[model samples]
Target chain A: MRGDTPFIAGDWGTSNLRLWLCGADGTVLDRADGPGVAAVPGRAEAAFLDATAAWRAADGPLPALFCGMVGSTIGWVEAAYHPCPANVGSLASGLTRFTALGATMAIIPGLSTRNPQGAPDVMRGEETQILGALASHPDLGIGRRLLCLPGTHAKWVLLRDGTVVMFQTGFSGELFALLRGHSVLGRGTDGLLPQIGPAFIQGVQRSLTSAPLPHLLFEARSRQLLEGMSAQDALSFLSGLVIGADVVGGIAMAADGLDGPVTLVASPILTDAYAAALAATGRDTVALDGGELALAGLLSVRAAILS
Target chain B: MRGDTPFIAGDWGTSNLRLWLCGADGTVLDRADGPGVAAVPGRAEAAFLDATAAWRAADGPLPALFCGMVGSTIGWVEAAYHPCPANVGSLASGLTRFTALGATMAIIPGLSTRNPQGAPDVMRGEETQILGALASHPDLGIGRRLLCLPGTHAKWVLLRDGTVVMFQTGFSGELFALLRGHSVLGRGTDGLLPQIGPAFIQGVQRSLTSAPLPHLLFEARSRQLLEGMSAQDALSFLSGLVIGADVVGGIAMAADGLDGPVTLVASPILTDAYAAALAATGRDTVALDGGELALAGLLSVRAAILS
Candidate 1:
């Protein structure tokens, strides 16, 4: 066995698994992608073995650290939730341990908090990403800030001194997809959410108003039928409206409000739309790459474990 | 051909067509159901012909009055929209006429209005039902009232002196189905919306608060996973939330601020949920059957034509 001690970092989610084989210096030496926990069900043991077979073969079973839904109830190991006011340290402090298929592994626990309404809210993977973002950009560690992670379930984190004080989840991205796939608003256009267009800009502007979302959503089709808006534009407009609502709604729910420019942890595709939406609302944003932050978050967890 | 001048009343919407062969006095002699305009496209004429062939043979192609999306641009004939501040008289006066395939037919025009933001809004079938509601219960013509028509696209009409002064459309029902069929909120539940349960009642209560809808929606799943909310109850809760949002949101948009108890024109399945939501919000409701009103609206159109 080539025993130089290269470690494995994984961001396993509901849909897919991403593994980064990193050298001692945290430089990626190799990578592997495989079916996510959801995709493999009871076969997660075999799936993991198959996915990282090469890495395990090259090095003699490196100790792996994982984050995301991999630690969820439906995931590899049911990692208990660490209640909030949780920070990166708290998450790293509570790792669920397991030994399977000749490899030792650990999963970072998710964060749990009661919303203002006292309803329990939980996030599995996003917490790890947020921590990673915090670690990657040390500047974000200062002051009270709003951190937005846009996705199927977009999270708006209220951070104070590098700890997640409270957070809100919006079903904006998933609802946008649901509307596009199943509603009349979805009619008349291809579903790809292109860059921010005029229709999308209109949606963002409308979101700043007091109009009800259920009513405002109908505009996607009404604008098309009455104004002769193209279907493609309608798709972008739908996206903008959903995102805009999230931003506007999220801001109102923030206990401290946004004290400074919001930090956006998003992929490239989402960067422009969210930036434009934020700009429209007269707010500034700092964009950070989500993939990079996720990797960094996992690496941070590894450090916490090794130390 | 036997001819007693019996009239045909048709409610043609996007997905299905429901028709009644009524006696001279507006009593239902027979009924027929077929695919809606969206289902048959260019074949609408032939489909209508096939749907009512037996009745046509007996009644010798009596005068037929149609309402709903059959009058939309995408329907049988592009019946023009009668602008709001419109009444039964205006709608009846704006019938688009056509003769095709051995039948004299007229489609009652839909109504159009600009939202407070000047965005163009239009409704076809619901307008007819509102008129029919007025015709069926003459008491409803007095003073000011709020009329709610719950369906795929629920409509809230502001009625003053028997005229529809303005209206708003909510995608609540459509959104409910979309979420149920295609969203994570849809998970952990059978899609059937049961009667008002504790989960549903909880949703209605939640809607009355200032919680953002996009955020509140995630509770459908969160409640399930965290609080042991059942799938069936989650479905009902989802329904309650959507309906609650529409009612609460619709009230805020009402220019006259609901002069009296709202009149909910809904099918049986939607009646309890909407009524409960309205009640929870400290409002009373007068329930009316949508189907009967649709038939009455068609009869009113026939009277408007013959008179």
Candidate 2:
């Protein structure tokens, strides 16, 4: 039963590379990883080959489906962005295919749309994750939906009739990291939020009241000095403030244009923060595990290619 | 006049220390500078001694007056903060006096006030700058006034009847530096805005329309990639967005409570940016040189101490 060679599913981005060897039944049979597109030097052909050598030796030359920053202009092979509104079928059709080292290969294209200000916004791997979410829950495709993928660059997406119509990018997560590590206001914070605490809720309340975030961020430090806030509490407060601002700003940008139950496709860590922020603003979220969606997306693309 | 060295006026901060030898007529005779408190490894006494050695050789034992981070907890000697509403008289009375290196020395205390959110807000050297502004232009002491000093830590101060009632700090400048150097949004930006251009105005307009700043900042990169914005334009655009956010947010925080023309006390470089941003928001500003105010503030404090 295990004699048959399988396909490879790769998620490569700026920071790290994650891979899975999937059987014909769509179950993961083996795993592999390597440096991300940013960390790999030269052509990246060697690194890819090296990362998968053992699996290749066991399974023979197998076809691979890759997503994320590997398709970016700065990545291995630049697969140009496909304009939305696009669905799973359209995304698969746009995949840039190539062959090297006796293996079939395909790289998923990123998505681009005009933001609220009518400027271009983009996302790479998350598009596949969205596709995977659609695959897992057909009911999610029935109506208009708002989807959020929270991470270093949080993406707030609008899906109309199963196709991603538009999206916006917020630098909230990146900002939190930068400020916590390198800023005076974030000096005392340790960059961890174990549980949603009082400080976090207070931060959400403050963000709702405070306009223009830069003016209020310093309170992270000031509160510690004046009110004896702990480092962990300060981090939580900062997180809530950023998330609250994102939610408020995202809604304002949406401006009643999109409607549906909000589907949050993120890791548990991010989901907790976003869920709390959304709840504070009187909105509820349906959580979707990002890893499951990612795998499902890879399988859908693989099936499309084989067909 | 050249024969007499009346006293040493120093603006010592976390990063840099500037000193001036002043004559009895309040004219600067000579100047020197050195690394600030943070740059000095162990004790700051040595750096202070070295910086003023030339002045000491000429003047014997001149009294010194310092204002800035030199009075902070991490500075030369911990000069405790004076609570507002405080004017020059109250500020002078809070001075921490000491005798070292056969020189009579005193450091002006920083000012602290609760912001609109009831969080602690503080400023050190800028307090002396405010005092200097009052000394140079007596008219500034009248009515309720707002003062903005834009820098690494931009300060927005409210003065009522010649006393500083309250203030807020925005880390706009530092954020700009960090983003430009460290964050992805600031990539390719040279961090120089030779003059405000169309790109800059566009940034201000975008910021005004886009409420939550963290969401909108990504436009700096999106515009460049989508519309082919040049690095110089991108940098200018980023600067405008930051200034705009600070101005808009600061006004909202003020909440129609503090009423007066904003006294922008800064160097020519910062004044240009803040002035343009304020003008864009339909607010006029009265400009004052930061150096002039720092000297005036020191002289005022010295006079207070002597009297």
Candidate 3:
């Protein structure tokens, strides 16, 4: 089915648009990118064409599906956000279509949850990974499961019988940046944690406990100024705080008693940190690569539509 | 009683020191400042003398006492920190003596608590205000109460019948500065929150319930860029989140179902913000000006030793 399509995968985000030219077997033939959703609101299609100008096949009529934030309100086309308890069944509403670079493109919608008294919770990019997860783990598509997706956002998502039952997002990256640069706890030393002694692990364990996080953070500076905890140690402590919070909070909400095996889809660094946190909590997890999941997800969606 | 002794009230923190000269009746007669604990160690008495060189009187022994971080480990002289449960019966630790400006000076020690885990919960300059609260509102010292002294480091303190039960610190002001300068939400309008209209109130309200505060901040910014929430309003939203979190998370543990009123001691602007938060939560509070409370505390401690 993908033979009719020139290429199959796209990871569209707030800041960048990445598209691939693939063979029928999904092998990378070529690739092109341009100003992402952030730069082009009304002219997303035009921008994509402009970027892919000379390389785009003259008469391919290639049909490609896009994933990530492209389906957001700010994307090339808006895709209706599917709510939690979302699976293949909840994917129908809030779909927007558009033509860009002479290729038929569809943006995938994220998920949403209506808070009882405030704004609703909404997401844009992680849905692709869920589809990919379902593709690789066929047994998980129809069962209770916990999926942890890591990035600027670390989402702890729960699935009940293949449907996303609930989800929560934490600002682990933002916190890491804030603590590393702006906060007193930040040590100016870069790449200090991943190469050190037990500092990183110590921080992970320290943050794993349920002590009020902020109170624990105050010590990051106080110890340095008072009891002499070093800046490097402080940085690790801060990192631990964010990672610990994400792992503990996300796991608590997503695992719901750890009834199911956990699947973590993220970069290696993140997986290592999560593994460290898991060890502290005496829990085990399955770590998967982000790129692989992303490709698998796009292929699955394309197959479902063609059928 | 109102004789020749010079009265001094101090606002001491970890970084700097400010002292007010007063008559026995607590009337302001002059003012001075010093390098504080951080700038110089083992030389607090000398630096203090230098700052007050112009104001030093040739009269009888200038009986002067000081508070703040000046008495911390890095300050002029370390005062003997007393364990809390500080009732009127047992005043905060006695002031230690030091030679400064060729005169007798007393440095008031902060209060510290020994947790069950054996870690010390310490307070320096803030103990002066707590002492003042006990002197001014004896009823507050008689039972379990929550006292909020809002400033750079807003301390939410709990007391059980005059014993310092426990306390937590929230850096609302420090956070305000960090967010205003470092983060994307830093583009706030100049000055206090009251000038910002509903954005200020709404911001504070949002912080109380916002799931992940940092992520929610983008809405404050983008709502203006894409949805038109206003720049000044966006800034206020950021402020509200920090202040609101200060109010909610700072006391989440100490004030849970605990009976009695919340007493707030801070400047006018912060007091108003706290009042707004209290109103949002349907909790009425007794707000006393920070300067006045510190003065009251200085006098009470002065009387205890002088008599």
Candidate 4:
């Protein structure tokens, strides 16, 4: 066992588990990654330990703070959710205690939702990213900001005064992967996204409205196969639908209204995909870096653990 | 040579290739199924010969009548298209002849699109089914009937006055498979489709006209995952969306504007699924036996060859 730092932070998602060794200042001095909780299933604790065992020292204890899905019910430990209008504490205060490699380890809390009448919709991982984004960009922390973290389960969260007001999720990416890679449309796409053009925009507009569009999709590929629409062009048309559907979903959530510019907080690829989709809607908004938010969240949880 | 038979009939599709030995009496003395045209690709002729080479010893020299994608540009040979309102003679009259098995083999023509700019969507194999159906159900030959052939590529053919008026295709079956097998919803479903109580009808209604459905289908699994919607129930709900969407599509194609009874021609499983979907729309339909259509189609083609 080796001691490179006194603290460790981890980002756990469905497919990946990443741990970072940091000093008191929150610099990622060393990092480790493995299959996240979802991928390993019921072994969140073991997975976490395995990733950081090398960083453990024979000479005593180090404080480790965790964020992301590790705090989920299926996570390293359950981090009960704090409802909307939350604070930095709303994101970081609810702590789940644990010990690994004889080091003091704790997992941060996640957020939950109570729809009009159902059981609470809890989110353990994304809440951490929200906290990180807010801590990094204090300006976005003020007033209402629309935070879009696009992924397998793209989260559309609304925030006010650093608190999560409300949020929803979309399966856009998953749908895209299924449609283009595994579906009959897969033949029309050939693993390539169509170039964004009029077809893409038209597809977006079609997805956004309540128009009877079930039949139009038949034409998406038929046009290419029967009408000679290029394969690339056909896929671009399809991308218009997937991305367009995403924009429509996010816009619907924000129907309550937006007081500030839409602050899209996501990885570059997803953020750009959303931008393209939203562009089809003819709406403009500002984009913030997703990595920065993740960092800021680590810092926030790190401080909360020290406190 | 065995006996005198004027023609040989073949049905070649994506996964199955079937051949029939028909006498002048239109009696199927023998029948067989092998890997379809798509599987054999460029070697379709050899594959066809290999499947029926036994006939070389007899049946004299006869023309081979074939249908389906076997006549696609990518198939063994390109069959010229007979536009909508095509007849049995219309299909046979425009046939493209190619020599094979030391016999005069004439591959039946395919249907083509009316789209001026794009490729005319056509069907080689299905045309024979239509011919078969018309011959067997001459009663159905009288008026406008919707010929529903549900499969990977579901075809909706409108027949008027015993002639195919206009037709459209939907990838509904394919979409259903991909969505339920490859998407996250697939995870919630576990590859089995159950009956969707009210959520399915609700989903169908919402999808047909709702602008920006909330929860992005996380709700489908959410009800199950968080609120106890059963996997079977969720699968049913998912099935409803796809099938319901397909119905909405067919309705959209009808100039009548979502106001007609859909005659769903499919197998028992697909028929039930369609019935479940049509529940929400409250639209009634006649579900015909799939086997009857195939048999009738084969017999009709056999009779036509002798005539």
TM-score of each: 0.95, 0.93, 0.77, 0.84
Candidate 1 lDDT over residue span A1-307, tens digit each: 1124687888999998999999876789988999989898878778888998887777767767888888877788889878889887788788888887666788888888886655778888888898888888887788788888999988888888888987888888888878887788887556465458777888888877766688788888877777788788888888888888888867765545656788888897787788889889878888888977789888877666566
lDDT of 3 by residue, B85-146 (tens): 55433553466776654567777777666432123356677888887877788887766678
lDDT string, candidate 4, B1-307, tens digits: 1135545677777778877777756567777777876688789888887887677556655556677778776678877777777877666567777787567766667776642112245555777777776776676677666666676667777777778777766556777777677766767566475564676675666456543332435666666656677777777777666666566655544554322355667787887677666656666666766654654665564455446
**Candidate 1 regions off by >4 Å?**
A1-4, A116-118, A253-259, B1-4, B253-259
Model 4: what is its DockQ? 0.31
DockQ-based class of model 3: incorrect
Q: Candidate 2, which segments miss by more than 4 Å at Cα? A: A1-5, A188-195, A253-260, A304-307, B1-5, B190-195, B253-260
- lDDT score, candidate 2, position A45: 75
Would candidate 2 be rated incorrect, acceptable, medium or high by CAPRI criteria?
medium
* Top candidate when judged by DockQ against the true structure: 1
- Considering DockQ, where higher is better, how would the candidates rank from best to worst? 1, 2, 4, 3
Identify the leading candidate in terms of TM-score.
Answer: 1
List model 2 lDDT by residue over B98-189, tens digit each. Answer: 88777778899998899755678888899999999988888888887888999998998888778898888887988887777789877765
Interface alpha-carbon RMSD, every candidate: 1.4, 1.3, 4.2, 4.7
Pick out the ten consecutive residues of candidate 3 chain B with the lowest summed lDDT: B112-121
Give Cα-based local distance difference scores for all models. 0.81, 0.81, 0.66, 0.66
**Error at B70, model 3, angstroms:** 3.7
Sort the candidates on TM-score, descending order: 1, 2, 4, 3
Which residue pairs in model 3 clash with each other? A80-A94, A85-A164, B12-B68, B12-B69, B85-B163, B85-B164, B204-B240
lDDT of 2: 0.81
